[model samples]
Target: MARVLHNCPAPAKLNLFLHVTGRRADGYHLLQTAFQLIDRSDSLDFDTRDDGVILRTTAVAGVEHDSDLIVRAARLLQQATGSNNGANIAVRKNLPMGGGLGGGSSDAATTLLALNYLWQTGLSRSQLMALGLQLGADVPFFLFGHNAFAEGVGEQLMRIDTPDHWFVVIEPGVSIPTAAIFASSELTRNSKPVKMLDFSGAYIRNGRNDLQAVATKLFPAVAEAIDWLGQHGTARMTGSGACVFCAFETRDEAEAVLASVPKKWRAWIARALDEHPLSHLQ
Candidate 1:
């Protein structure tokens, strides 16, 4: 029988705040943000196979199998270890794509972590993280295992304690491409950077997403969602987003607001998580 790792979770993350501090010469914008884990997630099941063939048994709409991050991460791990083993990865996706929830990156990180253990490749957490970075910037954070303050195109992570507040998230029913927002001429790229000490408090409204303006301007639905949610609290966009969220002090407060959210949009409430669900894997 093949060895299997089932129900491996890849939780969604909310960027408590995202600021474009500057632009690197390579065109990757410098960012400072706090990543907060939430209950919303994508889960995976890995079935080990003897042949050296990495495959995604589940298909995501509009995403090619060869282009899926899950497959790429698995293949990368194989190449790095020079291992002949392979696996069939089945994803149970619950998070929205292009909502800035880090779904794909999280899935990729989970693949790297899970396969390393299942295949008995014996890679360290730091080694896995280094390989994850080649997949995407947010991949390393998911592997980092805690809420963090990130910098340098979002690869620099310092564990930060986040408030246990509940968040109400609204998906505006549109896909906002991350590249479009970053490449926009109107996007702000020069917000003055702040020290980590300034954000150690992990308050709900510590800062703002510089990408929000460009995203909202390009997509009116996002602006409408933010405007509606802002009526309840300090509503803001997470990462380069199509989803907007507001943090509340308690579950009751978050649920109450969630009740009043317009029916035209998809919305839900999730409590903040201090660490990743897969933290124990390492």
Candidate 2:
């Protein structure tokens, strides 16, 4: 009988603070940020296939199989290990796409870890993380499986301990394209960098997302969501744009604000995770 790993969680991440330090000649924007793993996630079920055919049995709307990060990660690992085994990957997509929650990247990271175990590929953690980087910048962080202060093009990670706070994440009902945000002329390319010791837990209240200004001006809903969430506490855009979040000391406080959120928008309360669910698996 083929082995299977069911209901693996691919948790979303929040950029507690995002700063663009500079831009490279290759056009990759240099970034400094703290990635906070949250409880909210997209789950995947991996069923082993002995015939050596990787397939996404369940489709995510608007994402093609060939283009799906989950499928790409699976195929990448397969080729890397020269493994004849395959998988029927099914995803229960919970995180909103293009909301800056690192949904796609987390899914890809989870796939690599899960498949490596199921296929008995024997790839080391460092090897998997290197493979993840080829998939996406955020993918490696998910594989790192801990809260981190990241720099460079978001590949440089230094593990950090973040406060245990509950967050209310609101989806602004609009998808913000990361490329468009990064390419905008109005986007701030140079924000003075700060050291890790300067990262107080309340940094999000004082710090900013270098791309938020550009995104808010481009997408009014993002601004509106920020303003709305701000009513409860300090609010900030996580990554590029669209979804905004505010932190609270308790789950009740977070949920209370979530309950009052406008019905037109989608909202949820999630606790910050100390590590990725697959941390033990790795």
Task: Report the number of the highest-lDDT candidate.
Answer: 2
- lDDT, candidate 2, 159-195, per-residue tens: 9988899999999999988999998999888799887
TM-score of 1: 0.97
List the pairs of residues colliding in candidate 2. none
Question: Residue 16 deviation, candidate 1, in Å?
Answer: 0.7
Per-residue C-alpha lDDT of model 1 across residues 1-282, encoded as one tens digit per residue: 578999999999999888888988888889988899998899999999999899899889989999999999999999999999999999998999999999999999999889998899999988998999999999999999999999998889999887788999999999988999988999878888878776656443667888999999999999999999999888999889999999888999998999999999999999889888878874
lDDT of 2: 0.92
How many residue-pair clashes does candidate 1 contain? Answer: 0
Assess each prediction's global lDDT (C-alpha) against the native. Answer: 0.90, 0.92
Candidate 1 lDDT at 230 equals 91
Q: After TM-score superposition, what is the CA distance of residue 24 in candidate 1 from its true location, in Å? A: 1.4
